[model samples]
Target: MMLEDLYRLLRSGHVQAQGVVDTITQPIIVLDQNLCVVTANNAFIKTFKADRDDIQGRVFFELGNGQWDIESLRQLIGGIIPRAAAVIGYEVKHDFPVIGQRTFLVDARRLVHPDDNSANILVLFEDVTERQRHDAEMDFIVSETRHRMKNLFAVVRSIAMQTETKGRTAADYRDTFLGRLDVTLRAQEISVSNTPADFEALLRQSVNPLGAERFHCTGPSVQLSNSRIMPVSMIFHELATNAAKYGALSGQDGEVHVTWSLEDGPRGRVFLRCEWREENGPAVTMPEHKGYGTELIQATCAHVGGMVELKFHPEGLNAVIKFPV
Candidate 1:
């Protein structure tokens, strides 16, 4: 009678828990209320680097730490039951012995038995390190694109305004617009499609027309990826044009100095700041009327979460920009 009862229990389908675990796409792991491993699917076995016989009863946190180290995984899994909330897409990285690289998105669900509310918890693991990285890379590209186009708009507006107020005739304004656009394009190309922008490269190009002898550059390894290049390029254009027209480039002996630095602010965040100062130039003054270029600079700088300041002294002009890197 006892053997028949046991046989009937095993054949009733209730004893075969593995069937449910085997169907999931994500790695599924189930543990009793004490957090001891009860069952793990093949996906789970492969993800955690365990054989069916070895991992059936082991703790969840034995995986080495760093990128996908199991200690973090344990904490994440252990909390799901207590917190009674589903955790989704938590990113982790690990260097596993069996696998050269491990990056995973972990998900967990607090499982309760229908007959016994406190029996066990279910955890799901999804490998999505590649997807997360791709998303971040795409985000950087999009941000860079938006920033660069905004600067182009500003540059065009500035050219239009400058021509409208001072041009001798329609053709003169048209030609000047075209010339300014050409200069802007050089920077725009670097902003939009260009993967990276060098501070020195922009300065060199801006001052190239006047001659390399007229422009000087100073900075460390400052490279802004596409996301930040757009505004930086616009600021470059403004300062370079101003120096050429009114500051050092305006005179034969004029000199312009450009430098950059990175600083750590409150709460350990890094930022970029650039300074432009002129030597041997006329006094600077705020324009009585704001021009299109001025508006463009101000608006675009603010749009990209940056601040711009322009100063005119008896000696020449100085512009400073500070922004998130």
Candidate 2:
């Protein structure tokens, strides 16, 4: 019977029995004052895998080999329903005999007949397995985002404090700090997007602005880990900036060569070896003291468990960076 018909039956002071429940697609059951099943809808029959004849007029707990006879469930429907107006949003998660594990959100309401003081309990079941799974995934993503943001803030704080210590003047500090910050932002973008940071891609992002034709690079395809991507990119940014200002990239005839390889190391470890060579530039001379850019490169390499050797040849600047993989 449809709800319209059920409403008519109620108006005529006649209970339509279980047939009225079939109107709802959500698993539903009409129970008497004793909590015995009066009638179950088609949805309930299919969801619980029960015969209509076995369920009608039988106690709800006695259905499906007594799988529904749980302590918490009894407390909700048996203990609370008789005394309270209704029990709304009660959740039940259990494995049935043939249906396997499932989650359900239950809503039970006590309905008082207009003609009599006697009441009937209408229980509705909503399958929430998929909803709960989606909610769990969302929660995990939120938690991971918080964790990454915290880590990023820490990294920025470290950079600020260290830059302040090494910077010679406000101008130097602004330029150096902003350059390093750009590298950190790139790493964060890659991590959030869940994309692999290709070594070539990061190199281009750092140096291409200086001039794509100013540098020559040769290396096999390598994807960098999140922890290493920021530090490595910062190292390249500092080197490229120095080249653009004073090294090979400073002149039209000057250029830089960058090569890298992965090799086996002692103690069964792997190592990444990279070399930056510059040529055809102004006569090279070593600085009397370490500059902010040099310090930035060294500190970044140390953060990622790597080492860098900077040397000045008459031709140009040569730097070698190595790290364990």
Candidate 3:
């Protein structure tokens, strides 16, 4: 039924008026011109955990130890309603006892008795706390996605600039740059996925394409935190790329052994130590000068508070990587 119909029933002193008001699902209260509670529906009493005897004659602002004495509510009812005669969806946030924090959309209307020229205000409260929380979470996700995209673009630019073109054909340069770019993007993807990236999974992603037979990997289960995943993944990628080009994976019957363990560090801190050993490839010799791949590997390791030690042995190459967990 409409507000007008309820007003008429209340004015006519119909016994069923209270029943009709109670039938409404939304919490509602009727107040006199002086802002004293005239009547409250079942929803209002149940919602606020109040009694009929305590509510009927009390001032709206003084109800329940003045929990309802909100300044915004006072201004809306005392100041705004007089001029507007009606207000719809006026928002109010309050921390209520028993219910904790809550947000409400308040709708109010001033109903006047035609014959007697007396007035009563009808107020309705709609709860929207959960909806607001969901909206806030969505906003955070959007902002985080934008930030990741910008970082990804910056990383790609760095890779393109640092990749060497000297003494290489166009196709060779293209392949090298694209390979690094692919590794960076893959790291980004794993970092953002619902499941967190782990040490073994990242290693497999970096080197499995070269053929699983080329590498034997064994390590204790270690979970990578979000900030550490990208750098650690990139480190593995660069190492694998180098192995494929000049170390174990480049020659038939060659193999790489990958293993890692967690160790206790100074001040009770924990660290991860990983070993990558290549064997049966071409005899190892130190490069005359540092290359971009070596620099990239070092940079990525340092990005995550880590370090790498590369050794050129007669059999092959061995790298020892250490980083904080």
Candidate 4:
């Protein structure tokens, strides 16, 4: 007879069932026609903390000191089977004496026994409490970020309104507002990407589009919060704009020295310091009038629990900013 005529499910008694059962990663529970545990995989034993001798011939629910009496979970799994299109899973809270309470993702499927018209169930699970918690936290962050951005826009509008009323002329107000927006945008650039980058790389990237070729920057490496890149970028943008207009960057020999390092950590205090200095510029002086850019730089630094020190010496303009680590 052709080999295709033979039954695959009716394995010979010599066939090693234990060898196959131990190889699966997903927890597998094979129940006999009576819905009694016939066998379980190593993965299943580890997951349920029940020994093979203890679980065999016993009902799955009553196997582990009745600890697996997760009602909704059993119902969800009781409905699924092999090649079945249903996506069934449940979260079960297990409170072991020493381990406290934890949530696990239990997924189950039923399979038709090839030899008999009976059925078997296989359950797989992983602890997903931490994952769920993290997802919730991330969602909160996203909502908070949107809220903060809207508030910031409102603040920008207020600055625009005040500057329009206070400026000497309409053109003066227009120039001031445009500069203000650019600074604001630059300060927020680093947060635009989800990736982490060193401080100097971030600053260099922030300054590039704003006529960076006309300027030079030097700095050492320092760790930085990914979200803080944007505000700092704006600060640098304002500083760069000022230099291009009236400071060292306006001159051929003008250069910007940007460096940073960590200081001794104080008790319960976390801080990092960064300095950006301008060189070979004409004499500098404070502006006769306050504008949005100046206010933005000060406010942004302060918001980050830090202060920005601005120095206008004959050589150039320099700024030192400290922020919470």
Model number with the top TM-score:
2
Weakest lDDT window of 10 consecutive positions for candidate 2: 12-21
Cα lDDT tens digits, model 1, 1-325, are 6999988988777546666667666788877766667788878776667677766665555423332435666677677677776667777676567766767777777776566566577777888767877999999999998997897688688767755445257775575467567766776667657577776776677567664785677888777767766566666665666566556677877778778898865556567777877887555566666654566667667877778887766676677877777
Residue 39 error, candidate 1, Å: 52
Per-residue lDDT tens digits for candidate 4, residues 113-208, read 577345666566667778888999999999999999898889688758745455457776677677767656644554566656577765776556
Backbone clashes under 3 angstroms, per model: 7, 0, 0, 9
lDDT of 2 by residue, 1-325 (tens): 8999988878766445444657668998888878899878899999888898888888888888988787877777765554756677788898978888988888887765677455678789999988999999999999998998898899888888777554267887777788778878876777667766788888888899898887889999988876677777888998999999898888889988999999877777677899999999888899877777888888778777778899999999999998765
Better of 1 and 3 by lDDT: 3
Candidate 2 local lDDT, residue 244: 91
Candidate 1: regions farther than 4 A off:
1-172, 191-194, 265-269
Error of 1 at 217 (Å): 1.9
Error of 1 at 155 (Å): 10
Candidate 3 at 129: error in angstroms?
A: 2.7
Error of 2 at 226 (Å): 4.2
After superposition, which runs of candidate 2 have C-alpha atoms over 4 Å from their true positions? 1-20, 80-85, 165-169, 191-197
RMSD of 2: 4.4
lDDT of 3 at 104: 88
Q: For candidate 3, lDDT tens digit of each residue in 153-223?
A: 89888888888887779998998899888877777777768576788988898888986877899989998
lDDT of the candidates, in the order given: 0.69, 0.82, 0.84, 0.68
lDDT leaderboard ranking = 3, 2, 1, 4
Candidate 4 Cα outliers beyond 4 Å, as residue runs: 1-165, 168-192, 210-214, 265-269, 290-292
